[model samples]
Target: MTGLSTLGRLAPLGAAVAAVAERLRPSVVTIENGSGAGAGVIWSADGLIITNDHVVPGDQARVRLGSQDVVPARVVGRDRLNDLAALRVPREGLPAAEVGDSRALRPGQLVLAMGHPLGLSHALTLGIVSALPTDDDERELIRADLALAPGNSGGPMVDAAGRVVGINAMVASPGLALAVPSHVVADFVTHIGEPAPWLGITALPVVLPPDLRRRVGVAAGLMITAVERGGPAEAAGLLPGDVIVAIAEEPVRHPRHLLEALARTPAGGDLDLVILRGGQGHRLRVAPARRAPQADVPPARSAA
Candidate 1:
């Protein structure tokens, strides 16, 4: 009788999950470039689709909608730094995923991911938010304990309420997946063609010593390896070998976090940076410059 009661209680939850998956199926899409295939999310009813920049390497591809309709899609904008790309299909009144506040997400909360994994169409996977950005770490990616395959690169990672919270990005390890938070997606979508703010510096993540960590109140920092000549960073007196701990009051443990903070700041606006030089902490102000007019080049991987 106890077992029967437990099953009865689970029946409703299973039904609810099924219902959510059904509703999301229409918003998830299959993207196919000449070399390979991936998944995407219908970001708008007017045919704007969101996927990983790695998924669509070319200017054009094919999008398969829920209605089994296949249409040509043009790559509208690509942010290789964030690994996000926007595509536009020639369709309207499409079912679009409801955006959710990824900042509101908490660890251990339930999440559902939809994708066409391993050529399987519209597959659903269940998991929980393994972790979120922390003040000391400030990674822009959402870490989830979900199984993600190659084909899952750009599908929607929705909550139990069927609201899109993230885009399935990549598998970090076995049973661990990473996602680009929906808030980041919203920002990327809003400024599709605009030049991303640039801070001309190359840096790399470095672990701070215990004494430095205690003094600086940060676990790690990005060590500046090079500063572009005549750029904002160099003009601000930033030198190589300096370790940057925070940007505009936001802790940035990764280059992506720094880039995201720069993206939020207006062009030519003053930016406050907290850094350590020779094991001593100091604050400096710099203005981010605009990227030169060119094709979307990947941000310097060493650090930007």
Candidate 2:
């Protein structure tokens, strides 16, 4: 009798939790069109944080502090194929996030979502790891049931240990979120000593299909969809119809798989391309010429 129906009993507890969460949120400072604004998060401290490439797409993208302070962020590097980007702020003596290994993560493991949802500022949501999608990059990603919004792009997803396991990067409407797993991210940061071109490719994972599972065939790799004329593929004699089965003997699937193979292949060095054409396979070794530039989005932007 004392409980005032279901709705009335839930209001106060909800308000208390919201209050605490608001205070704990971090800020993601976005600099666009030469203007700066705040985006919130759970980790405000410093070092380097991984975020969506679009968050800092241009020559400049910096993060803001909880106290409304701004820090200049530069492109540490980015993986366009995966839509994952990493930026570093030069704020030393700031709080850095603790990196957690996602390898040990199990399905339904407790996880928290932190970001600038809907561009509103810093926000946090609770959920559990629903799945880990293995993209062609040979990296395992975090998939969760927590609600993620637009502004929350590039925030940290921490676990009970207060260590970051993923970066809040994408959402599938309503309440699905996907993150770049921390393990791959950590290696990226430690090794990203230089910037690399983003060869937009739909790298498919090279897993033998059921029919070919036991045949000891080529590992699935990026099947060349459309090659930019005069681009690397064209210069190297890679055709649009070519199925890039591997690079330097490593199996590849369509899209990023081939590019990854190509990227690791030194520029100007003799590269071996193993492709399937006309249901038959061929291996060609050739020097990789510089890939020519592409046209800007037609009708979207004229030649500048």
Candidate 1: list runs displaced more than 4 Å: 136-138, 209-219, 248-251, 278-282, 292-303
TM-score of each: 0.86, 0.67
* lDDT tens per residue, model 2, 247-302: 67766644444444545655556657777776567886655454332222221111
Q: In candidate 1, which residue pairs get closer than 3 Å at backbone N, Cα or C atoms, i.e. clash?
A: none
Candidate models: Cα lDDT each = 0.87, 0.59
Worst 10 residues of 2 by lDDT: 295-304
Model 1, 216-289: lDDT tens per residue?
Answer: 68888788988999988998999999988898777767777777677678766888999999988899998888
For candidate 1, give the lDDT: 0.87
Q: What is the lDDT of residue 76 in candidate 1?
A: 88
